[model samples]
Target chain A: MLTKRIIPCLDIKNGRTVKGVNFLDLRDAGDPVELAAIYAAEGADELVFLDISATEEKRKTLAELVRKVAEKVDIPFTVGGGIAAVEDVEILLHNGADKVSVNSSAVKRPELIDELSGRFGSQCVVVAVDARQVDGQWRVHLVGGKVPTEIPLYEWVTEAERRGAGEILFTSMDHDGTKNGFANEALAHISGLVNIPVIASGGAGEMQHFADAFLKGKADAALAASVFHFKEMEINPLKAFLRAQDIAVRL
Target chain B: MKNIVIIDYGAGNIQSVKFAVERLGHQAVLTDDAATIKKADKVIFPGVGAAGSAMSKLRATGLDRLIPELEQPVLGICLGMQLMCRHSEEGNTSGLGIFDADVLRFPDSVKVPQIGWNRISGLKSDLFDGIRDGEFMYLVHSYYVPDCPEAVAYTSYGIAYASALKKDNFYGVQFHPEKSSTAGAAVLKNFLETVS
Candidate 1:
């Protein structure tokens, strides 16, 4: 059986991990490699590094960080944020990043998904959608859910799958940071609309929220940031909780 | 010291494979050169992406002709393993004809690309000596090699398929051992040290 994955997302800025990761055992919290190794050892099914840097050297710095993490960590990880072109994904994959996710750029050009999947195979391309409910309709957002677009969520994910995106990472903007739960209704709708795997993101406040995302939303995987970063929830215990709920998790 | 050569025909994640070898205290050179691959004591063929394009690159470099002829111990990963077979449904590509089996896409009953960790059972061969039955391996592919005569290990997604296969000196795994944590690393080390 293919087990459901638990992913810890790390935000990167200029080759370092941001966010208040309160792992007291870490000598350097900003060191993404060490943090990645820790997460891997602690049984994180995967990791995602969102490079939010806007420097001229952001590419080189992220590439360097990717190389370090790949050398030390033994689990698969994805790199995203500021990924607008094929060349950016090429350098990151060359440095050993397993997968690359495209968000605003895919909405901007749409052809970027086709070119990426054509050049590097769909398995390595992850299409991330940030959206919120707008008057009983889900509207897509860009740049960390700041810029809004007229495109509806269900139709967009259907198109992304057709465009050769192997997976869809759907983050509900309205439920984000509220720590209530995932947007299961919309997630279930997207899952039914696409044949590919769906990753439910945002609104993961409790462990049962993950279960609901899987059982209710029908998500293939679930991703969270602050809860895992702040030690409010640990991956192993979370997996244990999900297992007790009769969910298939990699123990 | 062993000369490890990774066939780099511009197909897949060659760097991670190289680093995985390095973690085992061995050095591997990524080369498309036939001479380098022929001279190596061991060869690791790692690939990801489309079968047609990967086969074309191998054909362009003449690695397609060179690979099946090499007598040294060779291991193929993911799409590399599928290409070692006779044919693949992906891109409607014909393979190198190393394995007698054919590659197939997973049924619509299951997700297209069955991602994440799945267990390998019915294990045999030196590649899984220390690894136990039901030990998980990382796999990410829509197409799979059905259980055949060469199958030494199996995994069940929508159906049981060959997760690993062996014939004479050649070995292939549908999973990415380099990315599969400790269990996967053990498989790689077993390949480099014992599977000869």
Candidate 2:
């Protein structure tokens, strides 16, 4: 049986892990490589490094950071946030990121998904959709959720799948940072609509939320940032909890 | 101090495999040079992409013929494993004929990619030495090779399929051991130490 994945997302800014993860055991929480090793040791199924850095120089630094993290950790990790082209994806994958996620750039030019999947294979392409409920309809948002589009969440994911996206990382903007829970209603709707695996992102507050994302939302994997970054929830115990709840997880 | 060659035919995500080999303290090289691959102590045939195109690239570089004839230990990952079979449903492509098996698509009842950690059991090869049954390994694929005489490990999704296959010096895994954490590293290490 395939196990539900528990992912810890590290927000990277200027080639360093943001949000100041202050674990006593960690020698340096700001180091992306160090934090990634800690997460991998703690039983994280996967790690996601969202390179929030915008400068070209810092992006190069992110590549170096990715190489370092890849050397230290054996688990699959994804790199997202500033990926805008096939070359960007190549740089990260060459530096040892298992997959690369594209968000705003993929929406700005949907054909980019086709070109990427054609060149790198769909398994390496992850189309990340940031959506929020607007006027009782889930609308896709762009530029970090400040801008809205006419494309509905379901329609966009369907198109992404059609364009050869291997997986869909769906983030609910309204629930992001709130830690209330995942947008299970929306997740179930999208998961039913697509054939590829859907990763539920944003709005993970407690361990049960992860279980809910799997059971109620039908998500293949659940990704969280703040709860893990602040050490509010550790992955090992969380997997144990999920196992007790009868959820199949990699322990 | 063994030389490990990761056969490269423009496939994506070979870097992780190379990194994993280096992490095991071996000198790993990514090359399409047939001579280099033949000279290596062990060869890691890593690939990601469509089977037809990947096969085309292999043929164009003359690697298709060289790969099967090599006497050294050869481990194929993902699509590389599928290409070792006799045929693949993907792209209606014929394979390298290293393994007497056929690759088929997972039924529509299950998700197309089966993308996540899955357990491998019924280990029958030294490739899984020191690894327990039901240990999770990262898998990402739509097509699979069914159980055959070469199957050394089995995993069930919609049906029981060969998660690891072995025949003499040729071995293949449907999962990405490079991305499977410690257990995955152990599998690679076993291949390096015991397969020879």
Candidate 3:
């Protein structure tokens, strides 16, 4: 009876926490390290720090930020965004990131997934797929969800799993900034296809949204950004609500 | 200063376990030396790799014999705990005969490497002090020990298996406390405080 997890995502740029609507118009949230410590203290199941900037300047800053946050919190944390090589994954892991998430890079060089999984074991690698509804069909998006890949959403997920990715992080680009609810239809479709843990991201407006994500969407975890960063919702109350709903959450 | 010795026989996640014990306000010494392991106030044997290989490493260092005879409390984690049983199906290897159970692999119909945070219910030991009946603990094991008299906690993945075991001075958990959050840290702390 493993309980479903609830994670708060923090986007990092220039060594600071930033969040935006659909990956644009970014605003400063807080210091990345301090914000991470606060979330961990507030009982966030896990944290994901995505480096929005891929430049050398931002990369070095993000790596140091990860190291600082790793020293502050005992819970597991993951680093993603602009990670293009096996050396990048190793550097992040060595810098105290429990897992390294690959999105665009995973789609570009699919072999990197196998090479990383073969070296570090599947448990440490997470394949992040950004999907959007195109012509009433879900298609995989690359380059931060701006470019569409040739692979279908479900097929790409299966391929990533076959390439030895431990978990699949599927983010719905169309529903990302809406905050109405999760793309349950897309999540349900993918969850049924993959045996590995599927984490649902994008379009979480209310506490009930998390419940729906787990119950109907069958997501192993639900990750949200603005709702948590802007104090629109607090974790303990949301967890309390989920618990009242009889959803298995770590209180 | 209570010295907690973690046997380091080239097993898995040794440093993390040592860091966890040290973070809990105790001295955790990672050692394979029988003399130091025998003299520690409490011992923790944590592993994450394959069972047969871990047992082979322990045998190479002769710690397989030195562990069970210790008068102090010893906590075995993951593969370290599984290797304390009569035999393990992993690599078809025999283990230290401390528990009267055999380690087994789940059926093909069920998922292999049952991972994530699962609730450990039916708890009946002091190791669960300050923890609720169905506390969720993180687990990542491919093989499990079948339910036995020593089972203090049971969790159901595909089938109900022994989540926690207690046999005299030897205690074993199929989960990693170092990896598990607060609930797990409490289990390790309770083991250290109560098992003397």
Candidate 4:
């Protein structure tokens, strides 16, 4: 059977990975190329580098960083953030990102999604939806969870699928930093409705949370931050915990 | 100087493969001309994308029939490897038949595209030299060949499938060694060194 993937997401700013990274190695841990090599050796299934900067200079730096990472690390990696157009997706992909994730851009101009998926097969396109429960309704968040799109979460997910997204990366902003666990109620509901793989994001405080996410929530993969970044948790042990729980993990 | 010819049928990812081989200090020429391919010491058939389209392009250039007759070491990557088989369920297309295997689609229980890095174990030939049994290599394929005598390595995705195969002068891998990092590059390096 196909093994469920374990991904570590690194937020990049000005060609450097932000948060949870120590500046000890090679001046700082923000160097995307060096950080990527380390993660690939640690047996990370996939890596996601989100360019947090919105400026053109920062985007150019991110593209250069992506090229460096692609040269050093030979694994599947995805790039996101500031990806608003098909040209943006093309540039990143050409630079070596195996897949490109679109969030706010897809919501603002859905035609971009259709155009990208058409140009580079659907498998190359990923739709990342950052959601938060607002007054009993799940609402989508844009601009790195700062701006509200007013679009319902489920409706947006369904629309993304119809628009040719290969996978959905759903992040719960409310449960993001808490680590209480994943938003199982929301994920389980989405998994039942979608045919493509659903990757559950946010609220991964412990290894067991991953188990629960796979078993109860039916997530194809889990993306974590603080736990893996701070060394509070390791991928092998987390995968061991999940495997013990009878979940399929690439060991 | 060992000259490695990489077929560029305009249907696959050629730059990465050429770069990977060149990084190891070997010459990898990406070309569609028969003269250059025939003059090379070894040949690499690298591809990505659909099977039918790849075969169509190969046939259009007459390289499909020309490839199997070369008495040199040939390594086929991903879709190129699948095209070497007798037939493929992908696009209901026929193949080079260099190896006696049929490529079948993964059952729905497993995902369509078996994407990501998976461990390849049970080494049986020189192709796996210096490579540990459980070491992981990168893979991204939807159709796989069932067990055959030529299989040098096996990987489990939706089911146990052939990860590496060697038949006489012909060798094939379902994974992309060019994009598989150091280990994958090592595998290609090994093939380059040993394919006399």
After superposition on all CA atoms, what RMSD does each candidate show versus the true structure?
Answer: 2.7, 2.9, 3.1, 3.9
Off by over 4 Å in 1: A20-29
Off-target runs (Cα >4 Å) in candidate 2 are A19-29
Among the candidates, what TM-score does chain A have in each? 0.95, 0.94, 0.98, 0.94
lDDT of 2 by residue, B59-138 (tens): 99999999999999999999999999999999999999999999999998998888889999999898998899888899
Q: What DockQ results for candidate 3?
A: 0.32
Task: Give the TM-score of each candidate.
Answer: 0.97, 0.96, 0.87, 0.85
Which residue pairs does candidate 1 place in steric collision? Answer: none
Summarize candidate 3's per-residue lDDT along B74-130 as a digit string, tens digits.
Answer: 898988889889999987999988888999987755444465678899998889888
**In angstroms, how far off is B170's CA in candidate 3?**
2.2
Model 3: lDDT of residue B119 = 85
**For residues A1-251, could you state the per-residue lDDT of candidate 2 as single tens digits?**
99999989887877777642221122224678888888888999888888766786977898898888888898888889868788888888888888899999999999999998888888878899999988999999987777899899999999999999999999998888778999999999889999889999988989989999999999999999878877899999999999998999988
Candidate 1 residues B16-128, lDDT tens each?
Answer: 99999999999999989888999999999999999999999888889899999999999999998999999999989999999999999899999999989999999988889
Top-lDDT structure, candidate number: 1
Error of 2 at A130 (Å): 1.0
Interface RMSD of 3: 2.8
In order, the interface RMSDs are 0.6, 1.1, 2.8, 2.7
lDDT of 3 by residue, A1-251 (tens): 77788889999888888888998899999988888878877978888988887666876777777777765666777789988887777667656676779998888889989987776556667899999988888899988799987688989999998898878889999989899899998899887887778889999999989999988998888999999999999998898999898887877
Give the top-scoring candidate (TM-score).
1
Q: After superposition, how far is residue A12 of candidate 3 from its true place, in Å?
A: 2.5
**Of the pair 1 and 2, which is ahead by lDDT?**
1
Candidate 3 displacement at residue B16 in angstroms: 3.8
Which one wins on DockQ?
1
